[model samples]
Target chain A: MDIRRLRYFVAVAEARSVGKAAERLRMAQPPLSVQIRKLESEIGAPLFRRGTRGMDLTEAGQALLARASEALALAADGIEAARAVAAGSRGRLSVGYMFVLANAMLPRLIPELRRSIPGVDLDFAELSASTREARLLDRSVTVALCMPAIHHPEIQVARIGAQPFMLAMPIRSPFARLGSVPMARLQGRPLIALPPPERDPSSSAVAALLRRHQIVMPIASRVETVHSAMSLVLAGEGFGILPACARLGAPRGIVFRPLRDATDSIDIAVCWRRDSHSPLIRTFLKCAEKAVAPL
Target chain B: MDIRRLRYFVAVAEARSVGKAAERLRMAQPPLSVQIRKLESEIGAPLFRRGTRGMDLTEAGQALLARASEALALAADGIEAARAVAAGSRGRLSVGYMFVLANAMLPRLIPELRRSIPGVDLDFAELSASTREARLLDRSVTVALCMPAIHHPEIQVARIGAQPFMLAMPIRSPFARLGSVPMARLQGRPLIALPPPERDPSSSAVAALLRRHQIVMPIASRVETVHSAMSLVLAGEGFGILPACARLGAPRGIVFRPLRDATDSIDIAVCWRRDSHSPLIRTFLKCAEKAVAPL
Candidate 1:
């Protein structure tokens, strides 16, 4: 049966009187009775029995009521889900993000997105700047939070926020006593560098900053992520230069100090394919913008 | 936008031409172009650009196309889910059943129901015959499979299958060695009987069968279900009379043999509220009937 008929049936069943049901439904009793009669005939079962008091459900009537209610509820949910999706507040959003950016942005964005679009399913994966671009091109991820260095012709980038570079050192190190370490003080020290400039823009930006200051820092190790660099620094391997966002959840043994002579900072942005248009992606972008605005 | 507009957009996007899209949609190109223009205007963005080769999607066009396609798919799924529920091929069916009969019926019925209604979510709970009636009446369960002794005025019962009385004995018992055991042989022996006749029809039937055969078996204990009786039997407490369905998944330590003098069988039936009209219930009943027909 259609939703209208089911609704009519539920009103009549609940009211147990045609006149009362019609009154509640804002309809005439005769038309309501006719519809109920039509529904009973369609199913070939009498849904109601007239009694001395009023009317009561027959065995088949009770059965129909149970099913009709469920069917109507399911139909309503389906419609709501569809409308929500169309409104860009429902469906799945796969987000690719840098580990450091996620630590800063996700804590605020995830909860706010959940509150705003309770129907949307959020999926996340840790990705470097280059990998995020590849995933965006292939449509593997709906959006990415990374450096604003995307050069792909089909990728669109929107700058969210920027954070200046900071030095991560062992908490007990001599430099930890200083509020900020000068570029000159870091000369000849073992430095933990990020992977090649081709794969990571943050590390490339750091390298350029060091070169601009004419600091001849000896590279002790190269790592793929800020987390790994932090691990190495925790082990007293070398000091690491990372973005300000990376300091959000730094390990207990690590301390973050600003570079005294550094004017360069990492520009963080949200990226998606220029050819892609998903409501989920749009909603996510909006959420990302709102999250970064507060910072 | 509505589903119709989204459908038109998807067709145009896929074909990359208004003419081809019209041909596929079986409409004139002019009207299709008008609709697309209207959609673009509504979104406040240019969705496509006319070029010498063909039409190319603008940045906003790509975005709309992606979201429009997803919204349409979700809407389609919602309709399908609603239709499936109406046809008894979707939704959740919580079934209350006896442990023994479930072993006999579920293995066949569950897969058959899944095949028939792939969208239906099946949930099962083990319950006694009396409990099944209570659950059905309270609407805690959608349907139940148990002994056909439901006396509730509001409950409807449909007999699915019946199983003749079988003698369950420990593997080491002398009766286990026999192909079939006569009622007379077990006279005056300790018998693990099911709970008194009022709550269980199977036990009541067995008691009546013993009275007809003039066998005076002394009861060792009175348990609520065949599974409990089987456990006691396995411990060499006493021989037990149970429906043949109980033998389907009997544990390794127990053996089942037909009772020589017993002709009465326990009638298994599916039950629901007499007034219930649930497609899920109807689908479940149909599945149970098909499952029992083979047996």
Candidate 2:
């Protein structure tokens, strides 16, 4: 039977009379009586006995009473669960972040998230240039923290922060003593290059930035991750051009200096699918903005 | 949310387009779209992206999908469970039977019930005269197998079978040699009477039956149960008057002799509260009829 009929039956069973039940339900007696009769006929069993004194529950009525209450309670629980998720207070959020962003940003972001959406589960996926766009598109990750943030028709980006390009070189290098270096000074220098991003595999972000500045740096070494790039720079094999935040986790004996000639910088961005309507993704994006962006 | 909203959400989520989902649901598109919009607004989250191509589930929408299906399924299961109990096909049945009737009736009844309603859990309560009416009215027992069946305003009974009163005396007793004995011969003999039924305490059934025949028999002893009455008869305290079924479990030394010249008999009946509308009770009563009645 439907929930409304069960409600009426429970009322009649408890009150032991349709008149009293109708009063409790705030309805007239005749309609309540009709509903009870309809329920009994639908169930193919009598749910109550009409007596001179009042009414009495049949065995069938007793059976339905306990279960109907449980069903109603369960339905209520379902609605509350959906509401909690939709309100962004509860759910799972898989965040894909570049290693450099993870080092500087997570410490600030995690605490903010705990305070705001304590019911959400956090999943961290370390992103590589090749996987950044794929993870967001495939939904393996709901949001991403990317440098030189992804540009795609199906993707949306919020620039939480930005940092000027910096050079990673051995402490003993001649340029380390000079402090900042101009883009023209690095035109003929051997450079450590990272694998190209998923969206543009023809050239790395550093190479593209140099091309925009009319500087042509020769590729000395190519590596999979920023750590490997730093290792090469530490070994004096080549200098690495990196986001300014990368200095936070730089290897010992390596120094990062800003490139002075160009104002070129990379975005510390939160990216997600353009169509993603997940409340948790939006909630996380706000926290990310707070954690890393300028006031 | 209510089950209907969840149903619509699931349809749209699966179809990935409101127009397509509306077609599948056999409703017009605009109304379906309106319902989906109402659900999203009520949930306070965007459940889908209204892209030109089609609809896509938001993270919150994904979270709700699995749970919504579960809630709908649970509601359906609840209705099915209630219908099963009301249909008399599933539930528990508590049966209270007089000791003598239990000896004969249960064997036939239990098997029939198992065949007819396999889901019912059977509970048996042995009834004594003092607790008979109280058990039925208080609902401690749903149905009863009684001899000299109960008579009360709120109790309804159907006579399944009956047997004339028979004499239970020791094998070595002088009257044991006779095929039957006249009620007049029973006059003045010591009798073992059971405690009176709950409704009447002034006289036991055998005492009342004797009074109906205008014959007076001396009360040599009184006992609580049929077993005790048989034990007293075996001890030569008094002869016992019992229904024929008692012979099934009678002690080896006792012989049952028909009482000639007396049409007085005890009914083997199934009794329930007049107010009881339990389908299971009615179902059990029918099985009782088949088990103990002749045609």
Scored on chain A only, each candidate's TM-score is 0.69, 0.84
- Flag regions of model 1 displaced more than 4 Å: A1-295, B15-20, B28-34, B50-55, B84-97, B102-125, B134-144, B148-156, B167-191, B196-203, B211-220, B234-239, B245-260, B272-295
Please write out the lDDT profile of model 2 over residues B1-295, one tens digit for every residue: 4456678888999999999999999999999999999988887777786779899876667777766666556556655666777777777889998888776778888899889889888898999866888999998999988887888999999888887789999998999999998888887889898877655665566777788778887888888887889999999988999887788889899999999887777778889998776678778888998988742
Interface DockQ of candidate 2: 0.27
Local lDDT at A229 for model 1: 93
Instruction: Pick the DockQ winner.
Output: 2
- For model 2, how does the per-residue alpha-carbon lDDT over A57-120 read when each residue is reduced to its tens digit? 7666667766666655655565566677777777788889889877788899889988888998
Q: Residue B271 of candidate 2: its Cα lDDT?
A: 91
Per-candidate TM-scores read 0.45, 0.81
Worst 10 residues of 1 chain A by lDDT: A74-83
All candidates' lDDT scores? 0.77, 0.82
lDDT of 1: 0.77
